[model samples]
Target chain A: MTSEQPDWIAVDWGTSHVRAWAMTNAGKIIAENGSAKGMGSLAKDEFEPALLELVEPWLSAQTTVVACGMVGARQGWKEAPYAEVPCLPFDGKTTKVETHDSRLDVHLLSGLSQMKPADVMRGEETQIAGFIAAEPDFDGVVCLPGTHTKWARISAKEVVSFQTFMSGELFACLSNHSVLRHSVAGKAWNDETFETAINDAISHPEKLAGRLFSLRADSLLHDLGNAEARARLSGLLIGAEIAAARPYWLGMDIAIIGADTLSGLYSRALELQGCAPRCPDAENLTLAGLAAAYLTLKETSS
Target chain B: MTSEQPDWIAVDWGTSHVRAWAMTNAGKIIAENGSAKGMGSLAKDEFEPALLELVEPWLSAQTTVVACGMVGARQGWKEAPYAEVPCLPFDGKTTKVETHDSRLDVHLLSGLSQMKPADVMRGEETQIAGFIAAEPDFDGVVCLPGTHTKWARISAKEVVSFQTFMSGELFACLSNHSVLRHSVAGKAWNDETFETAINDAISHPEKLAGRLFSLRADSLLHDLGNAEARARLSGLLIGAEIAAARPYWLGMDIAIIGADTLSGLYSRALELQGCAPRCPDAENLTLAGLAAAYLTLKETSS
Candidate 1:
């Protein structure tokens, strides 16, 4: 019942959403689909039956399935052990799960972790590998910005380590839901204000972490324009993260991987941090990571 | 038909809620009456009718009507302009609300304002006065912690100037409501861990803004004990707020105004900042403010 045509599905599952790519052997994405049904939305047993139906057509060709995201954590199937720092993706080991249906070969990737002021990342691992696929054998850090912005150090075929920032989430909360929410002018981006905030934040970086009341007063009393206040808020937070990542990233080459809209903020932040940005098509990169995992599995079995 | 004996009432009026107190001049509170009648619930015109009915019984006697919170704002009735810094209660010229009903000689007191780094406060002006009532008028800073915490520099009867912090609101949104809420430990009051976070945040103060994510990962990766992580998170944020407030508050005596449960956090934070904390009862400080306003009105007319 299987078509001789080979099929591989690559999934970048995250906190809020999931994206799966159907790719050919040469790693060209022929057909694709996505679902709002993110990892957070699913219970442990739901991923298999749900995933099979979406990738069913390609699966008739004996497709191998690969996955990433919180879908790969302790809450995830198989309890993939935390990968230690400076470790590579699929570092000759994978968290393999044999689901209800055996026809699908499923591989869930491992999350990366670091120590003492420690951090870990799950969905970003494949994105890092995908970037590696686009520009093979590249060295440096890959920055992904979001609710949990991620930074990964990559060398050879492995991600040496990475850090995560709850930047996007904090930004959303501070802007819309908190008491300071009413005090700010929302949804408008001004670079001058943003840059000024970044400079002020970097200059008096400690103030970046202070209670947000001064931010409101600055706008109200000091007549800090709304746009500048907004940018300053954004800058103080992002600048603080950059300050933390500096010890790990200084003097290293950096590539920012993610969609254009998603990664633009990180790009601006990189410039402020004296690093140039490289935007990789996240869709293709995830497929590339799946391809790497599938091929690694195939070669090891052979 | 009017009752001659004094009765007690407690009033808690805010932007969204309106309350009235009918009380004896003695500390003991008697009967209380209030309605959904908050400032937001009615138009500006409905205030007179609503307020009259709230304490109709006490109007015939020498009953003193004590009001607190936002009921005395410029928008409430006759606009009360702000008193400048360093002036105590009854010191500044207050704008009186002269209504046709002679029974209600509403003594609208002046709020406080500062010109440099310009800021203004209305209800808190009374709270500051109440705080002063509870303690000797010392040259110090009094912190009123809530959704928007006010840190004021007071000299004698005057609130020289103050800064606002949206600390409580930010903490609520980030903890119980935001996505990061789930990741936070379910424990409270880990002073040791909180102290560590304070030290870490103060040392690399820039990272103070970025330390939130560490709370989640420190637990997930290296088993960062729950209470410690929670405390650390609190310390980091409180430390940052203190750091920012330090510029405005250093060298001034600092007192904290809050109920016991909530004020302890602020006290611990002040301790972290190496500032001894003086906490007076926030009990009916609002009513105390209303009483002060009434007394000032009587003395001024005499």
Candidate 2:
């Protein structure tokens, strides 16, 4: 964006948390800060100001700002439309978000312009952009597993539609808060159990939805230890995701981006599905996308 | 069991809550009270005083008490032995409980006992006894569905053995507290969607566990409304329980117990399984069980 040594403010606003990074023109982190409070909390107006405080140290008279995530959704400050599949950085409409400080010209990055019956997403648009920046010529599929695990088929710089799975959220709720908690211990995972569940699920997918109750009975009837049960439950959920994401992953190389604990799970799961796994450095992609968005905005708006 | 009408105390103690019912000689309610503090709330000593206060208003020198539930568990006042299935009143041990009030003679009922792999229950034993009191000659399976649904096979006035399913608890936590909440709207049941999930589960029993992630995806893909999605999710869970409970249900008639709203739901599910449904009144069952336990104690002892 700015040719100056210190340029724009980069933010990744997620559902449960917010992460902000101040970057120099050369793409080095000037400063980084984060908060547990995310888009799920606060009124839309409170968002920009709260974020401003975190990057206040770096905010000068002309610092360009770009943000991604649910903060650009319908519930966000302004609804950023979805960018359609198979496109490059911030393919959707970018908005000039309101800021308390006029000196800080913030460019809220538009998400992907997804066209089906509707349009959606603000954050993943940036993520896809960053992925393209890092691997500009790559063409395949990327799976981002979380509350909603999104599997996108990417060709060149654009996302060619995608499928979303509720695997992560279901796993969390079923394991921790539901009766399955007694059956499945916790975060622990066992490979044997995982593989067994995957095979069981893949073979009889129609029964996959109903097997949740057996988690408890299986634990009580036999000693399906907590770790095995948890891993088995994970397999059951992610296996379902693989089924739903099949159309997206068909004939495509799959790259998974997440922390080691989470991405490793997907990698293992992908391997089971006979797909090769590509594990990328998440931080690098995020910064690359943010910088790319800033660069795009600088060129277009200048 | 007491020939003479003297004030009686009936208690249902469980892991986390304690409920006491004060009844007349003829089982008419004199008063009732409860406490959030349960066996889980205190050590052995603290139980007496806290329990005393909960029923202090009806406490008198002439009181003969028979208590049920976890008050007799390993964590309660003293470990009460379990009553084996085909549960009849007094099948369990009679543990003479000591208290600070010399005037009050409390006979804490025994928990349902299993000698083999060793599993038992305290409060549910009383509930089964109550069910028997309501339908003294009935023989089949009675399901007390809740956070833990207990299915007991009754014959010859003995319960044989019962299996507990954590159905309601799972349903509550998922609908109210989990990410699936966003995917599922409304709390009411939708028979069509529910039946689909149930059939899906039944068709492929093994994969039932894995299909759970489909709730959110189906919601997103298909235009099923949230209320229907919630009901379908619930049906998916309960169907799994039905599958697990298959052993206990074979050759046995089904009696579902709960408020009409909940019990009706179970009845419909039972119908789906081709089992006839009979719902005995639940409002009076707990108290009736206490009465049965009291009467049994009176007959065997002085």
Candidate 3:
């Protein structure tokens, strides 16, 4: 807990975890904490207590709290609703929640949605807002890799369109539940093997179904190393994603916002295809985006 | 239990279950039984007891038992090494296991392996053998759809080469373990929806990564029914498989051997691609193959 009282609080609550930050008036983070209590685990009435438990020390009389991510989802504390595409990432359109405690004023940020592709994103929109906030002139495709990676086209301070890929989730499911689980049971990796697999998948995306079983077969037949099998599995899934997302990244300025390890793999795959991508720290962007939303809430109230 | 003693026992011991049939000297089934005691659950020493528990009433003095499937795998009861491809599915090669009871005389059949692409199959080999035993001139591709679907190119009573696809397992993994689990719950299926998704995946296999997420997005945004989602998920995976296995099925006589529901889906998907594949009952073929192996054992012993 921080000695100084927080002027406001910023929260990024997602599916599996909740993260909070105690911010000063000038957007300085005085303290930070997180818990496994995420949207997926909590009930509608339990959100307030879960949040309060994490940041009670920083609370004061009439302190305003601005939250983003799944906290604003339909099944969340309050449905902030989705602001469709061709709109700014954060345009002061937030859902204000009526808390029982007089000192607690909670506001949830709206996520972005696309109608044509039938795609929707929560939490990621906040990260995009932060990326745009940091580089106002950044106009290109922004790829946010996670359980479900999102690729959004940003132009003129608005999201033109976006697509979502479940490659990360597919990788996890296949490596854990499928027959390949026994072959790729370790965290070890082989870069050369990964590169080869990426090329194979990119060239023949149709063969992905057939190629997946080869990992297990090779392990059983020629003693294919667990690391190589692991790397190849990752490469195959990511390569297929890159192949499907060609229109988004081909001959376009690109920025990849994700964790170092995953972003690095994406960077390597793209670089193999002769494209360079700028990678930004994901956590910092989330914090920056939440702070931006907090500033907007303060302005509207004043 | 049957009053008459069995001459031999035909067992299809796979990963999840052990099925045994008491056979007469003239290939007549007197009784049939199975248990959850699959090769996956039994240790090397425990396989004898599991087999005895199921066939104790049928066993007599020196009862010959012919077993196939994962029972011959390296980790199974006895290691019956894989017989390389371009060879007969089950020739005269069989691994004999020493049992504690003198009444039990057991032999495990060999699976097939492909060296170039590094593929292997255990239980499906017996099915292929059965297919060949029934139709002695099946000089084309034999598709066995299951947890791990196998596509074997047959030529002149030999398995020239083969490939394995995890589409079935992939479908199970994605629907049960991935984020799509929430959207694709239940068994309701829409044929029209399935057909459309099949064509989409077959045409643009590269776009599969992008299309998968749409199932979830459509469910969330447009109320895509669980039935439609389930069918679409199955279609996309099976379609991708058909696209990948095109080289094996193109212009070649195709035969699908599996359970009714799964084989029907594969047949439907292939029919959309202008190919008519023969659907054979998987159980009858397994028994025929095991009987063939038993006959070979009797001849060699005599």
C-alpha TM-scores of all predictions: 0.85, 0.79, 0.98
Residue B82 of model 3 has an lDDT of 91
CAPRI rating of model 1: medium
Docking class of 3: high
Clashes of each: 17, 44, 0
List model 2 lDDT by residue over B41-130, tens digit each: 789899878877786666546577777777887668887765554447556357888888876778888766544433445577677778
Q: Write the per-residue lDDT of candidate 3 for residues A26-109, one digit (tens) a residue.
A: 878899999999998889999989998998888777888888988888778988899999898987878899987778989899
Candidate 3 per-residue C-alpha lDDT over B231-262 given as tens digits, one digit per residue, 9 for 90 to 100: 99999999999899999999999999999999
For model 1, how does the per-residue alpha-carbon lDDT over A25-134 read when each residue is reduced to its tens digit?
A: 78777667778777777888888876776676666535577787788877665567677777676565677887877678888887778885588888777777767767
Give the higher-lDDT candidate: 2 or 3.
Answer: 3
- List, residue by residue over B1-302, the lDDT tens digit for candidate 1: 23444443445566566667665656555555677776655666776677777777666643445455555664565556666665674353555555556666455556666666555566666777776776655777888877667788877666666776666676777887565565564865676776776667656667754567877887787776656766776777766677777766677677788768668887876677677888877756767766666655556657
Q: Rank the candidates by TM-score, best first.
A: 3, 1, 2
Tens-digit lDDT string for candidate 2 (A158-222) = 77776556567767777777757777865666898898887676665544534665675566445
- Residue pairs with colliding backbones in model 3 are none
**Winner on lDDT (1 vs 2):** 2
- Tell me how far the alpha carbon of residue A222 in candidate 3 is from the true structure, in angstroms, after superposition: 0.7
